[model samples]
Target: MANHKSALKRNRQAAVRNARNSHIRSTMRTFVKQVRTAVATGDQAAANEALGRAVPYIDKAATKGIIHKATASRKISRLAKLVNGMA
Candidate 1:
């Protein structure tokens, strides 16, 4: 428990940020899963479409500091490879 006013405010801010970050992370995972699901179906067009939609969300999450930039690049790279390989 935080006794000081500043500490209490910090706790509140942290809680809010935690919730927001969790939501963003969950949404990012959903998008990534969509891309993977599309890829697994072996439909090139659908996979490509999903990848296209997913990349921006992944990048945005990285830029927002929810995920690391290299992690975002790796995810995009892997998904792109999967989509391209379907060709």
Candidate 2:
């Protein structure tokens, strides 16, 4: 119950942004899971490919402010290390 018109508009905008951010976060999690699954399967090639796809998704998520920059970097680094260890 926003009394002011601007407050109402801001509330609407926040709802929209929340939905969009949720989708982005969900997609990022899916990508990360795919990479981890590939690694767990012990398929180096598949793991590498999945990691490749995941890196940009993670970077984009970070750039969009969905995730912290250091968190994204750590994720990418861990994925890379997993891929490297498989090789």
Candidate 3:
């Protein structure tokens, strides 16, 4: 439904970006899930390690505009708290 040529090109670019963003977002969610699973299992060391891995991915996602920076910080904080709370 893109009439102009430039519009068509933009549509194509948007589609590509959408797919890439979706992949990155899915990966971020998976990383978060891993950290949560580790916490749920009460493995403090594993949870810490998973949180370490997850934070970078979250930051990258935020930088890439897939997620908000504050959201990323909040997620990292919550995960760290969960890990810390696991005696």
Instruction: Candidate 1: list runs displaced more than 4 Å.
Output: none
Q: Find the 10 residues in a row with the least total lDDT in model 2.
A: 78-87
Model 1 lDDT tens row, 32-68: 8998998888888888888888999999999999999
How many clashing pairs per prediction, in order? 0, 0, 0
Clashing residue pairs for model 2: none
Task: Write one digit per residue (lDDT tens) for candidate 2, span 23-68.
Answer: 9999999999999999999998889889999999999999999999
Question: What's the CA error at residue 60 for candidate 3, in Å?
Answer: 0.2
TM-score of each: 0.95, 0.95, 0.95
Native-referenced Cα lDDT, model 1: 0.92
Summarize candidate 3's per-residue lDDT along 30-54 as a digit string, tens digits: 9999999998988888888998899
